[model samples]
Target: MYTLKKSLGQHFLTDESICRRIVASLEAYPSRQLLEVGPGGGALTKYLLELRDIDFKAVEVDDDKVQYLKKTYPAIESRLIHQSFLDMAPPFEGPFTVVGNFPYNISTEIVFRIIEWRAQVQSTVGMFQKEVAQRLAATHGNKVYGVTSVLTQTYFDVEYLFDVPQGAFNPPPKVMSGVLRMTPRAAPLDVASERKLFVLVKTAFNQRRKTLRNAVKSLFSEEELQDDLFNRRAEQLSVAEFATLTFRMR
Candidate 1:
């Protein structure tokens, strides 16, 4: 048995039913190559191994958990990659699906990583802190909508699958967990420069309480800032609107 490390955000999912449902969600978006990030206690790993049609692999940063998982799920022994997901390349040369009960502390970074690999990751299903899940699934005008929502929705069709209770884990997290299913859009939203869009989105949200005119003044000319659209706050702009703004920025 491996001890949970607080630094790693390891709350091992212990509920059998929740485990089945997560794997079922992954099956809904079938893929030949799949990667499970942070297979903490192997709750979901148990079922993922049974998917004979897929080439499944698990990535674990913790050496103890990696050893534990390999011992517990001998079937995944050869396929397990001992690594922090933030550090690895796409598991396959071609397209793949990703799934996991992701570490909460680094969950935001994980989303960014997935976006960086958007061309290769066709779909993803995973558990995240409920608040983060909502942000990822939210559209403009939703209170929780912010940078993550804009960036993720720019590239994927985000679905808020379902919520999981704290009691579902061995050492429950303080907050409720929500599962999300993200599938790549047929065509990602257009942007003049991906870099500019990212910078603009982050800048706007950093001053979210201010109107875009006031918040993003530094990015635009006085005339551009004078546009009627700048009267709205960052949260008021849809992802497409943000993309349009990106092109207008200096």
Candidate 2:
């Protein structure tokens, strides 16, 4: 038996219903290659392996959990990658769908890494802190709508699928968890470059309360900043609006 590691944010999902729901969400996006990030206790991993004709891999950071998973499900021994999902290379060369009940501590950073691999990540379905999930699926004018919302939506369509209560886990998390399904956009947003869009959005939201002119003044010239759009706060702009504004950045 593996002891849960608080340092790893290990709140293993104990609810079979929640586990099936997550797997169902992943099945909605068809991909032969699948990568499960932080498959803590094989709650989802067992179900994922049952799918036919799919090449599956799971990344687990904890050696104890990895050993436990291998002992419990010998089939996963060869499939599991014993490393941090953050530092691992793409599990598949071509497109793949990612799934997991992400560790709360590094959940947002995981999303960022997924965005970095956007080109090959066909879709993703994972659980996150409800607030973080809302922010990813949030739209302009909502208080939770900010950099994550803008940057992620720039490449994928984020869907807030369902909520999982805190009690669904063995050692229940203090906060509620929600599942999100992200599918790549049919076409990428027209931006100067992903880098510029990232720079512009991160800069604008760094001072979210300030008007774009005040918040991102360093990215654009005083002349360009005079546009009426600059008068609005960062949260007022849609992902497309942010992508468009990237063209005007210095």
Candidate 3:
């Protein structure tokens, strides 16, 4: 049996039903140029390969798992990459789907990386800690809303699909798991202004307790943010409101 690796934040998915659900989220795609991040023990990988016309590439950080995957699925030996997902260059052209049962610790970073490569990725379906899932799908007015929510929402239409009980994994995580589906926006609210908006969102959430007037004070003149909308905390503003603030700053 494959053992969970603490250093790698490994928790292999043993539940086949959950695996199918994760894969089903990617059903909208025409080509199956699927990129599976951290395919621990190949549970999801196996299912993905069974699809007609499907081709898969997996990025795995664990050396042992990489070797095992290569040995177990010789057909995909050339496609399994042993490098860290953060370091590996994205293969394939534009608009591929990425799916996985991600490592809990690095899940956020993985999503961020995928966002960076949004030009190549059409959509994403993955499992995350329930708390993180909530944050990804959070709206501007939700208490759980913050930098991640704002940044991700700026680029993708996110959905909190379903919850997986702790018992689903081989070594069940203490927290519940949630599946999230993310599709890139047709056009960003302000595509060229993303950097400024990112900075503004980060600053606002960094001091979430403070009103936007105070949190974003450094980025704008007092006169610019004197509007009534700036009087509320970061959590109180919607994604469009945040975009408005970003445009004003620019």
Which is the leading candidate under TM-score?
A: 1
| Greater-lDDT candidate between 1 and 3 | 1
176-232 in candidate 2: lDDT tens per residue?
A: 999999988877789999899889998999999999889999999989988999999
lDDT measured at residue 43 in model 2 versus the true structure, 0 to 100: 94
Q: What TM-score would each prediction reach against the true structure?
A: 0.97, 0.97, 0.94
Which sequence of candidate numbers ranks them by TM-score, best first?
Answer: 1, 2, 3
Worst 10 residues of 1 by lDDT: 185-194
Greater-lDDT candidate between 2 and 3: 2
Over 4 Å off, model 1? none
Taken over the whole model, the C-alpha lDDT of each candidate is 0.92, 0.92, 0.85
Model 2 residue 20 CA deviation (Å) reads 0.8
Q: What is the per-residue lDDT of model 1 for residues 100-153, given as tens digits with 9 covering 90 to 100?
A: 999999999999999999999989998999999999999999999999899999
Q: Which is the winner by TM-score between candidate 1 and candidate 3?
A: 1
**Model 2 ranges with Cα > 4 A deviation:** none
